[model samples]
Target chain A: MPVAKILRLPLRLAVHACSGLVEPLRALARHRSLFLLLLRRDLADRTSGTVLGFSWLLVQPALQMLAFWFLLELVLQVRFPGRIGFLDYFLVGMLPWLLISEAVMRSTAVLNDLSSLYSRMAFPIVLLPLLPLVMAGAIFGMVYIVLVGLLAGPLAALYAPLIIAALLLWLLPLAYLLSVVGLFVRDFRQFLPFVLTMFMYLTPFLYMPQMLPEAMQPFMVLNPLADILAVVHHLILGLPVTAGNWIRPWLLWLVLLGPAWVIFYRAQPHMREAL
Target chain B: MSVIALRGVGKTYVHYEHVLDRLREVVTGRRCHREHVALHPLDLAVEAGEVVGVVGLNGAGKSTLLKLLANTLQPSMGRLEVRGRVSALLELGAGFHPEMSGRDNVYLSGAVMGLTREQVDALYDSIVDFAGIADFMGEPVKNYSSGMFVRLAFSVATCVTPDVLIVDEALSVGDGIFARKSFDRIMQFKQAGKTIFFCSHSLYQVEALCDRAVWIHEGRVREDGPASVVVAAYNGFLGTPGGAGAIVPADAGAGAAAVTHADPVAADGAVQPAPGAITARLLKVEVEVDGVVGRRLQLTTHRSNLAVRIRFVSDAASPVPTVAVALTGTDGRMITSAGSLNDQRQLLRDTNGVTEVTLSFPRLALLKGRYAVNIYLLCERGIHCYEEAAQIAEIEVSQEGLEQGVVSLPHEWAGSVES
Candidate 1:
């Protein structure tokens, strides 16, 4: 079969893409018990034999937040334009940032890591990529609860759903696309953590967007994470917000996700052989 | 109704010389990879409740066929309609988690096989019991033996009662006792009227368990028929000395239309018979029963007489030659051989340069299978062969009696049973 034949059937491709998107959701819903059990196992596997089992999830990110806080606030002497404290301002955006970062970075090797599932047993490949997301989500939810309790007022809780939606909208497509592409290019995994670190510095999560020179503000639009963090910062901290800031990230999201969806669906059939 | 129907089903894989070739093929609008056809287009329909065994040599596309049916690999071409759920035991411990306990693995594997948690829970105890490792269910499966692993894996796979069960050499593992138990479980499934497609190198198992058999040779179905007939033909093909290099005449056993071709001389020139010198050569060999001449000699009644006739021509100046014949199984193992010199029998020298000899068996006691005959003309001392024809003829023995092994030995029961 020619590649042109697959491209010609846009209707069929749309149907396949829709089904591909829904399959993981349906699998997770139908096998929620198994999903939860796997999630528990994943947590245990990651934390077992450590001195601090469950607390390690909080400790690692907390330490990283402290280190970044010291570097940005004390060393670099960066300041925000609002009345919100630096910890409060940073935690609000950092919570979702940590979630999306963990989901994408860990998911790059998710398929290769669970390759035994594909070769040894009859497993739904759609659910493989979702495992990391779900695992990260559980930890993220836990951390978010603690952060909201300690650092912010109850009003900040109202924006949790929107922040989560924004995070998933951005992370899911990238995770799916990268996981599929990662199977063919193993070096992508080796280069992933470096790239994610680079992405973090590029996004304005550590520093305020206003602190960036005016000339660099337009480039912030190019980083979807920057737009997402900006929305999260404004909604949770009551900072100033503009319609262009909130809406442009979503428009960029649409632009990024459309090709991811098509590429993921096209690559799915070939995944068995590639793996 | 057919539970599985495949029309012109085929699978082809594109082999790329380099990784960039694949990218180029996808990016550019040109084919840059070599196409390797794993399976040729063929039609097959398997009805519900039929146990069809696939017999083939390695790399003969048996696994590919099973994978296509199992829905693990997409067929490159053709239409395939598989009714009902398919559960394939393609390999043992395929979905097993090494760190998880066997019990947890069962639930996880069951869910992966499309069963809900509740369904797996309901069958959990039975699955553990069937695996016969209830004591170790709490231990991680990685600690289990290979047999135990296969047992747990097979138990979970079959516990769901899939509509179609495709097994590929999964049962060939483990101890003999466990193998028997697995076969019994499969037989129960067969009795329950589930369609089964089994592939194995053990032709005996295929013959014993399958209702029908499909012999795949070189990616094509060489023969498909009743299990006994197809297996017999395959056995005959394998028994030929040169493997597949020997061409089987189309009308091999179709009666008087005999086909003849010169046999290739032996590789050792010193051992090769003199070229163009027909001192003593066997012309035709046939099996006869009750004065009837044919290629196939059917043994309906036990202890029936069978006669093998050989026609030859020789010059008077040639040394008096001895005749020898051997019967070999389909696997090319020699069952028995007889020689005139070995039997201390004398041949009546004929001056006409033509002769016919017949070796008769008073009681033909072979079991059900195709057997091949090897004919040889030896010098007077029976030490050197003037000419020899290997697999000269094939005889098929069909018996209604259920017997195992290559031959049926005549015996009498004298002891009484205590029961």
Candidate 2:
């Protein structure tokens, strides 16, 4: 009897953890209208009082891309191994990076910012982390359309949607994990921007992977973000892709997502008291 | 079937001295914070088509129970089941964006209340008309007055009627006219056979609207029964001397007699006496019918005598101590007063010991309604009240004659209107 009870405990925990993944997806699908409304409200609120409304979304990434373009390509004279121009590489890499960083960074304070909504209303709490993810996706989609039109041809632009899906798939779980952690840890928000800056340097945003030293080149594969950016660069700029390039980033994302999804699902019920 | 059911539901909040302490507690799995049981485990059930009112003092866990039922707060222990879609109006204008116009906010607020865009579109004009802010719909909500903001929020919230509605004092918004309209709309919801969980300090509304009432005290359910019974018990508890030391007296001696003060009255038409703190403390205030102590004194038009007994303990010797009792009408007007100084009686000193005073009224002449008695221990000439209890005891009058105003006057109709 004791052995059976002990064995059942593990099975029960496994079932509960799996349900954590399924419950949020079910809630999101059921409350899709509310999710869309929140997405719309967040977008409208961001640009409500500004002189230039939706254009500010485009202006920000445009300005960042130009600054990096000048510093890395023009001033430092960095070059890729292939005929890929530095601007195309930077644009493709920077856009998804912005989407990922903004999603993670904004999610760090999303729970606190919407604490009143959680405490006062009857809406599903799982959808809150998705708000920033969807908002960042919308911003990325707009910027991606413009950059593809200007830099890449219309045929190459067709790959933008698939890239977005990949970026969202990677960022969503991270958003959920960080949002739950942020509710408990107050220092995460204060320390996030610095960590993101360090992470950007660690990734191949400003330069290509081959630009690094021979010893450091192989280590770039450990950063899933670098792998994702390399995949985007190859897809958008028609650069050659290595065999392991596609498998490594996806494997890393799956590895991160399983724990993240379980932690987020387990943390959802306790968030009400924590807040 | 019960629409809302809870079994041994409890919510305990861990309070940390600092935010870092919370993070440390979570990380190290060590107890670093104090736990506050916001609500103790209890059981309750509300069947469908029933409107239940939750009455309690400010920190009595009424709002906590409502939030738990609304699913905003997860109970730390116990099982709670709320069937069907539950829409809560916990705070008015909670999700309204100030930068958005009223038109846009109506849609956003509707969606927050679980209404779809098509639903909001269908009820758009009706919401605007119900809010009575048609012209201001184009302007930003920030520009709207607080009343207008509440009106729009309330309109949008009620437009989408759910199976269960939970409101926490949101109907006390807007002017009296709009409040009445909002209340009428709530009644319409009740007529449509929806379950409502309402929390308010207004016992009169609870008595009038709810089928049952629950009184929460210090995070526990103290009493729960039919609306009238629970409200009466709550009023008796409030009126009982030394029960609630924190109830502030209604500052009624501001010389504004015409103002309609909204004091909470129980179902039996007896106001909850304002419990005040004074230099001398009132020990007990009791009513008697023919010298038998009772909760209520039943009186007829021209028969039956009523007596009120007031007991107090003074701290120091008061020179020329006088006891006064004034009957205030439902509108907060002083209908009549009897004081030792006004009667030109001899002054009494050395009022340190506990003393009891009894005032009797032969043939109670007031009309059929609730009336409050304001008691005071004053110095000579009624200059200052050394001890005061405003609206301390209530005297309910039942008159057989048809008299509309405060008191009845003997008369006969001689003239008649001719067409």
Candidate 3:
């Protein structure tokens, strides 16, 4: 059977919720070695034994971004405002977008992915999705560290700490919300990639939000990725980010994430049975 | 004092289907519309530090009772209470994912089972050792051998130091080595004085492990007593009239087959077939060929992945539950009996429960043979719950050499005699 069927088995809301975990509460405190072992297991499981397994992680996005750039820059002759190489423009947005989207979207499937482990041990289901986010953010952190510490612009040097903090802040809820909902509906199995695609265009991955029509800019700014993208431009390019870009989008980020926090909170009670 | 107590405990679950049914029910305000009444307000009492083996045909409310004892299911109508920490391995690894490695399963499933991170950390080395998947821990279980998988799941289940441990028929699988290890671990739990409620069809395992036994047929318990007595009664029930001898109404299902009569007499008891019985039975179960009166048969209905089939005779109007077969030994200690009564059976439950014939033989794997068998039925009038023993009847075995082993098992033999 496909992986989808196995993830869908525990539909009993009564069992999927709180009471189901009475026997296995030790997953909360006693099992640190188990946690590390599980973390190592997750890494080994997804990345080993396949052709170009871990390497594919790097090759996949790098190829995707380069393809997009070559299509626009070489074939279509489209250019960033200042004749910036297509690579620079695409990398500036796609890199963070990849990190953010993968971090947020993939987080939802963590619990679903480890159904084998969670079902048997009575461990914490919350760790399923959260572990992936931590991994993604760590990967993102390394990337950001390289770009800012070694090769990024003078602006990257100025706002490095702030960018890291904001990214971390943005990531916490992103990882949490997707995970909780994943347990309930696993809607991400299909819609998550599409959301990432939609977010790609909305957040200036290919072009600045300002490049679009004025009417559309507000909608774009409503996205957290757009706010972060605009901030990235400001930090790395030394370009000015307008007050409307910052405030409105910040409010939108808060709004987008507010209910997600509540969802994460409400879901803990029912998580064990579902896991 | 009883650590576990129940009075009129019952459980009802709604059938679940696709998303559409769920949504429709949500909109129409029909909560769990299709109710599956599991435990029918049955009463129970178990003292602390006692090992109780629960015997039941599948869906006879065995899992329901375990889950309810763990508070995973609250009673719908009766008061129930337990004053201790419970560690249930019910459907061990109920949430394991093959994609994850054995190690992760240990942590994730361990946590799900109630081991705090620190507790898991402390027992990490021991858990890994117990799973015996030491090398495969870092590898995903998708690649694990079946034996290895069971080891990991079992270790994680028993890792937490629990006050009460509930084990299902987990060891029913696994290699002999792993089974022995698990058996030892369970024995250790016994020495430590943790209350254990073991559920399995293996009377040998139950006899070896439990001090007392409770047998359930249908959703109600039929017998509860010392291991020797209840197990003997259960075996007697399985042998002859217990199964395969059910009667069907002349107008039940379309194209109904004609009913057959039970045999006349056997070693332990006599078989008497009543006229106007609803159904027929054909069996070849191996009984105590010429063993002493007590411990006549140690029938362990081989737990197969195969489905089960069973037959029984019921009175027309209503059927009640009854029986207490006493197996008298030739020399000494009373070995066992196939009782129709056990303490676990809430005899007064199921006042409104179903009265259809139940067939429970695991996937028709029982070896065909000509063997002696016994029968007992608890018949009740229209509405009451307590039932009277129908008849302690006997029959001859006819199924012969269809398969090998005490109960037919799915195995292959590959050795050839030298020419």
Candidate 4:
């Protein structure tokens, strides 16, 4: 093969990733009012007719956390061997997990569900995949801060916004990839919830990492989400975490970014016709 | 420079047997589906302020061309550029959410049209006023009547006049009064020197409103030029047998001729409708010229009296069907056609759901040539075809004097000859 041809794939991948990351932000800036209207409409659609309206976002997660606290702390009276209490660990881990799972699950079907909005008009469909991330981010980001403040002091709570922002950025590539997959392969959306449930079990959200069987413990490094939670625990709870924990998720993100973005950009022309 | 231009742009829809085949093609970089060419590659350009009208039978790919220019559907091949702001009423209320309030839908539609919040705010009052549904703006659109919905949709579409306006059959919106109001609004847009592109079935409106007309036949530009000439050609084509090939009744299945049954059977040997099958159907059509009854007749231009008798069977459950007859020259140009719908006369039928209508013309003025007669049974609205029997009879006309045109014009010259 010629040298230029050999370099062409990587060159195009690099170009796509660079443009993909910036194009959405540019589209957002250009269509700020339209984006805001859609966001408002999305939020309203979820909470319309409810007495609490938008506050349900905060209340729903808080209620789930309370149920978990009741089961672990009050009912079972479980204790962890580490410096972190079982209740605090589960609470902190569960919030981020909720945010990630909600965003990912919704992202898969967002394009298909809202195809009517852009199908017959000249619309910026790229804005749709980002909606789930933004909505889920706002809901959990507020609750994460309050939970951290209640457990570890206000000083530790300051990292909540940064952590949520980082998680959203990490999810960006996955959101774009899964959206295209879900639209083209409709069966993927029907099976996504089970996959997410299995992922939740694979990650150490409900129990300590040390509680895993010896053989399975070694493979925890393979899951980037495990690495992500480890980093989150290290930040807010000051738990011991290795440098690899910090490097793994970011490395995975960088590796998948180019392909995911190129896939999404290439699929855009077909999106109008997909539905 | 042309405000709107297309260079060999066309659309081909690839139909996969299953949706996953599309993904397979993307992954494997191989063809996996059948290709339907909705439009062939064609070139076109329009000046900055031209009112261009598109006319074609249903399914003639007129909507495909408009959608491509409106930036809704991406063309499968070639380059298309439409400069300046382009607003399309391709479908009225297409952006509306039935669950949303009318007020919110207005803003939503405005946003979809790329209007900023402040721009929408400036135009909100005029839009609401024009639609005249201020009292119902708070309610959900699902609760609104069809008229109210179209009124609001049409109002929002036209309130913000863009450089190029694309409309599809939106001129005849709402009731008679609102239709006139919408027509006046379109006239205002034309007077403002904005480029307008619209497709409508009413050829009279197309001739009156458009400076240029494009007649698209089977996804190709069959004719493109001055409005009157192209419309006349299209109108002439509509009178031919093959012109109605693309038009199938809404409830019709499979083929175009399936709607018309050949002849119904009756126990007493009389023409009667088939039970449980209630579509309006043609029974018999007879043409007579100068006291002679036959399928073919010979007549003189100034002495022939032509008459046509048509019998049809219709269901009492459906509205009375209208009768139309056409006379066409050998070249398929419709010399003239008349319908009872245009006369606004109700056709009476017996208790057996059968009616016979005869149309007569005294002193036939056709100069010379063979002419074919066509009969049609249409729905009460006169738009939908219930049944059609094209070229059922033929007439040959002979003229004594040298007249050059298709018909003889009644004239008397008062000027003295310079001898």
Q: TM-score winner among the candidates?
A: 4
Clashing pairs in 1: A120-B94
For model 2 chain B, give the 10-residue run with minimal summed lDDT: B256-265
Per-residue CA lDDT of model 1 for B271-382, tens digit only, reads: 3222335556655566677676655556643656778776666556655678888876655545677888789987765556556688987667777776777777765656
Residue range B1-419, candidate 3, lDDT tens digits: 99888888887765556545656777888763466777777778888889999986667888878877765554567888887777876766565667776766777666555556676778889989877678878787878877677677778777765778887764333543454456557768778988888787656557766899988777777899999899888766654444332222222222211212334223332233223232212221122222312212223223322211112333333333432232211111122334434433423322223222222233333343222222333222111111112212121123434454334446566779454
The per-candidate count of clashes, in order, stands at: 1, 0, 95, 0
Candidate 1: true interface contacts recovered: 0.40
Candidate 4 segments whose C-alpha is farther than 4 A from its true place: A1-12, B23-30, B245-419
- TM-score, candidate 3, chain B alone: 0.55
Residue-wise lDDT of candidate 1 within A1-275, one digit each (tens)?
Answer: 67878777665655655665566678678778767657765775687668998799888887887897788778987666667677677777787888987898778888778777776555677777778887777677666766775666666765575567556655666777888778887778888889879888887766778888888888877787777778777777767777877888766555555566667667766777777
- Cα lDDT tens digits, model 2, B1-419, are 98999999998887888877866877999989998888999999999999999998888899889989888888989999999988777777777877778998887777666777788899999999999999999888999999899999888888877789998964434654465467667768889999999987756558767899999988999999999999888866765453433343454323222212243212242332222222344456665666665543456656767777766554343343567777765444446777777788754323344556788877777778766667676544353344455665555678776768767777766668453
Write the number of the candidate with greater lDDT, choosing between 2 and 3: 2
Binned by DockQ into CAPRI classes (incorrect, acceptable, medium, high), candidate 2 is acceptable
Report residue A106 deviation for candidate 2 (angstroms): 1.6
DockQ of each: 0.32, 0.43, 0.22, 0.52
Which docking band does candidate 1 fall into? acceptable
Give candidate 2 regions above 4 Å deviation: A1-28, A73-82, B23-30, B170-172, B240-242, B249-419
For each candidate in the order shown, give its overall lDDT on alpha carbons.
Answer: 0.74, 0.74, 0.57, 0.83
Q: TM-score of every model?
A: 0.72, 0.74, 0.62, 0.77
